[model samples]
Target: MYYKEYGNTGMKVSAIGLGTMRYDEQDVKAGRFEKCAEIPLYALENGINYWDTAPFYCDDKSEIITGIALSQVKRSDVYVTSKTNFSTLGDHPSRDDFRRRLETSLDRLKTDYIDFYHMWCMLNLESWERHMEVLYSFFEEAEREGLIRNIVFSSHMQGDDIETVVETGKFKGMLIGYNALNHRFRQSGIEKAYENGMGVVVMNPLGGGMIPNHPEAFTYLTEGTDLTVPQAALRFVASHKEITVTLAGCTTKEHIDDAVKAVENLEEYSAQEIVKQFEGKGASLNNLCTGCGYCKGCPKEIEIPKYMDAYNQYIFTGKKKSILDRLDNHWDISKEKVLECIACRKCEEQCTQHLPIVERLKEIGEIS
Candidate 1:
């Protein structure tokens, strides 16, 4: 229940926030509402006041469950965060689409105003700029009309986007994909956000469950620490000076309990020690692909990074079928696209993170 100042907003948020992404599982054959409702309620009773959810998660069912669970708690005692998928905010989203989506979200959540509203899944500079205009306008109107209290965005973009957004000085918070496996923010983006007075909220603090004790991807820290895989991962993110809260999307009460225990006994570790812990054991971000598909426009029409991303997701999250299913559904990519990497070294040159793209792609094709 430790609290931290949420940026300069003067609001003290819990160091551990509740993430609702796991509430609605498409794979579950049974109903989830009864069990899902308890996770938030238990979290709230234990002092976790920050709740993060999104419309894209489980097709908005996560938000609906979140709202229902939070209804039992006083609104003033909790902060609810939800996001809109900006990919749908097309060149010109129709008034109906915009209004319908917003209204639907509010209704589903059963809340008059959301504590924080974000533009979700922002990946590139072009998408960021295009959606910023729409998002700022929407938030401005919502604030004036009392529909939302704060503005924010969640990004999987690089340092440049982080700098641009923070410099705007409009958003109250920024959710970044950060964890032991993905430390891009710590390199510079996180510092930039802090410099511009923006609150940093960390998503995927477990590298999408990769920080846990997976036989293939387990880091040295996982083997040496007294903490469990999840504990080490959560603690690593929570220990960061820049992060206000580390969000964990818990599916079961057991998941919630483990996370709560980790945060309750959370220790402050030096950055050097944390870095040393993950020095080896296949946890480095050296050859990782984020599945962003930014390198897909190559003349060769290769599905370069996505395959690697899927492989990582499978190994880390233990959601092999789910990742494969997503790739199978979303992209009309061919087997050749997945298997025909020539190692021309073209993709390696274009990667922003300077990852060994060709090698990773080859590994992915072989592994998945």
Candidate 2:
């Protein structure tokens, strides 16, 4: 397996890190710990040393099963990453509760310390501000007590929130949403973090399993080569020199094999070239928003990005039910938001892609 310098952390992480989110659902459902454990164990044998898991992944069995797997391997052979949701911060998280949570993770992983601990699901600056004072104290204490090697955060917010959080320079790393469809909006903050020498681990690099299904849509990434769509997508991310880890949340060995082969055969390509190709052909050139977030602060509090993502989903896969389900269930974006648009052209005016925001809203209303 290939390795890359994990930014200022000074760790040589496997370029193909293992994300243990989908660890054999069938095996897990059957209560076959051994079968599920084989997944990470197989990944280790394949030279993927950066094993990432969380308490929430795999129906809250990820950390437990991953811990069981880690116990069999030499502790030093892997760098462990885990996260805490802490979305319940309004319940008033005491430091002891926080430490207990960390200790519980360490206990489950069968390791004394986590290599990277992420403040999971960090959205905007306001959300962080709500927990800043408490989190800062807990982070320092966790480090001083050797519970974590470095403090990091994971965010899905591609708006001004990401840049605001990264510029503080308080984190050792960040895990943000990065993929072919989403990169344009997050690039600025990603570069800023890289500039500060912080490790950047990208989640949703496969567009949350959207790319592989629409392989034909991304033939442009192959660029006159015979690379498959997923291969092109993974290689495209590695082509960005600033990116430290392009996360593959694989559930199957086949999935790992695909990503491994993609990275193994990675050929440098121009991101601009790929994007330009998408703008014209080789990808769906529907009324797509680049996720620029210029249409943010909607007066009606509409989640325009969620709307655009759903549109892109339909355009990419030609699956109307999946698109509607994603917008409704996965993204939690209400179709009812269309009623709140107020016929405002404000979002259109601020759009860099100049997509038809009002028209899309009308179409979204007709999604049923």
TM-score of each: 0.78, 0.79
| Model 1: per-residue Cα lDDT over 226-291, one tens digit each | 767777678778877677888988877777777777666556554455666555654456345554
- The digit string of per-residue lDDT tens for model 2 on 307-354 reads 877877776567766668878787987788787888777777655445
Global local distance difference test of model 1: 0.70
Best by TM-score: 2
Best by lDDT: 2
RMSD of each: 5.9, 6.0
Clashing pairs in 1: none
The clash count for each model shown is: 0, 0
Off by over 4 Å in 1: 24-32, 94-96, 184-186, 213-219, 222-225, 267-283, 290-306, 309-368
Give the Cα lDDT of each candidate: 0.70, 0.76
Candidate 2 colliding pairs: none
